[model samples]
Target: MKVDLFDFDLPQELIALRPVSPRDSARMLVACGDEPFADKSVSDLPSLLQPGDVLVFNDTRVIPAQLDGRRGEAKIGATLHKRIDLRRWQAFVRNAKRLKIGNVVEFPAQVRALAETRHEDGSFTLKFEGEEPVELLLERAGRMPLPPYIAGKRPTDERDKSDYQTIFAREDGAVAAPTAALHFTPQLLEALSERGVQRETLTLHVGAGTFLPVKADDTDDHQMHAEWGRIEPETADRLNAARRNGNRVIAVGTTSLRLLESAADEDGIIQPFADDTSIFITPGHRFRAVDGLMTNFHLPKSTLMMLVSALMGRERMQEAYAHAIAQKYRFYSYGDSSLLIP
Candidate 1:
């Protein structure tokens, strides 16, 4: 399908610069199939879901992956997207043409990296100078990698250290936050528990590629970037049991949804998985693992839009988005969320 089909007009003011106070206070637009869209709050999640339904959350934590550095006199900015190893990372660099293979870029806090091979995707492999854990080096040298749509409007600050992370965040690797989960709070968790809605977690190191636009005119030409994810045998077994027992599996974010789809077989049974997934979900794609999705509003012509379109019908999602915009809901990473069931 044409990428233009997903395009929609959004006002600049609708883009959220920060989260609402008491996280769960953020608005949630419930888009249920063949029903009128319901305007609700994130705190109402317990009531929206059934007792036996399971909500799968991505436990990947966001890292301080943005770095400002220089190669000689040329200033360069790098946002580490994926981990290549303990000492190396794949990053998208600003002014990347100034860098070459084997050139060392000097960054603050006495950190430096050799610009290794440049990938065809326009990102570069940056190998840190020492054996010291690159994660530690990043702590001293990097800032939270905010989505460009938000960062371009304002500067990142100390508040982002806590604001950009979810309560469920644990494993450290993701450059971007699984924004949908940001609405969750301890109170919300307790409420869900009391309501008998079970929660499960999996890891999918969300790379900066999630924010990349689909440059392809047709969906077939777009290539998704690989993200490493893991689903343990116990978790897979439990999820399968939930489905077999006639319960729905709700993915808390696209990160969780994609990982589940990656692990599901043709028969829709989820298997234990520990590998890289670059699943590109479009409207015609059939979903196997998840019954519902809770996610943030996405950008126009973005892969995320396509994923949501696949979950909810394209026409249905288009109408939902139109309602969201008309009602003045916030958009993007720090934005309001939607509960989509199709």
Candidate 2:
């Protein structure tokens, strides 16, 4: 399908700049078949689910990945895009036009970085000069890598530290949040538990490509960035059991849904995986793992919209998007959500 097929117009006012005070108070648009989209609060999620349904959540935490540093006498900035090792990373350096491969940069405090190599996309492999682990270095010298549309300065604010992450985040790795899970609070978890709705976890280190606009007019030509992900054997077994029992395996976010779908077989068998996936899911892709998905409103002409369009038919998704716009629903990173039942 052409990338333009997924395009939609969103009024600037509907672009959510901040999250709703109580996360769960955010709106949820429920769409199943031809039934009219029902407007509801995320707090109503428990009632929307069944007792035997299994909800899979991505537990990967967002890191403070943006950093400001200087390449010797020349000032430069970088967003620590992805971890390559304990002391190495792939970074998108600002003011990279003047950077040479061998140039060394110094971060705040005593940290230093040397550009080891450069890639065609203007990204670099940087070697760090510190005993502190990469995670620790980022904590000390980096800022939250908010999307470019957010319009902010070098450092992140206190609100982003909490708002950009999910309440259940434990494993640290993602550059982006699995936003559908963000609305879940401790109280909601307890409610799900008390109601006998089983929960499990998978890990998909969401990459900065999530915010990258699709520059290709032909959807087939777009090359998606590979991101690290893992699905445990235990989670697979539980999901398979749920499927066998005629229960739904509902994915909490597009990231989790992608990981689960990537690990599913043509026979619908769920399997454990620990590797990088560059799976660019578009329409006509058959889904094997998930029965439904809870996801945030995505950007127009984005791969995320394409993924959701694959589940809900393209025309149907377009209609839903129109309804969201008409209702003044939020869009993008910190936005209202939807429950798409396939």
Instruction: Choose the strongest candidate by lDDT.
Output: 1
Any runs in candidate 1 off by more than 4 Å, and if so which? none
Candidate 1's residue-wise lDDT over 1-342, tens digit each?
A: 999999999999999999999999999999988899999999999999999999999999999999999999999999999999888999999999899999999999999999988999999999999878888999999999999999998999999999999999999999999999999999999999999999999999999999888889999999999999999999999999999999999999999999999999999999999999999999989899999999999999999998999989888999999999999999999999999999
Query: Candidate 2, residues 30-121: lDDT per residue as tens digits?
Result: 99877989999898899999999999999999998887888768888887767788788888788998788999988886678889999888
Per-residue error at 335 for model 1, in Å?
0.8
TM-score of 1: 0.99
Off by over 4 Å in 2: 152-155
| lDDT at 188, model 1 | 96
Error of 1 at 31 (Å): 1.0
Highest TM-score scorer: 1
Model 1 poorest ten-residue lDDT run: 130-139
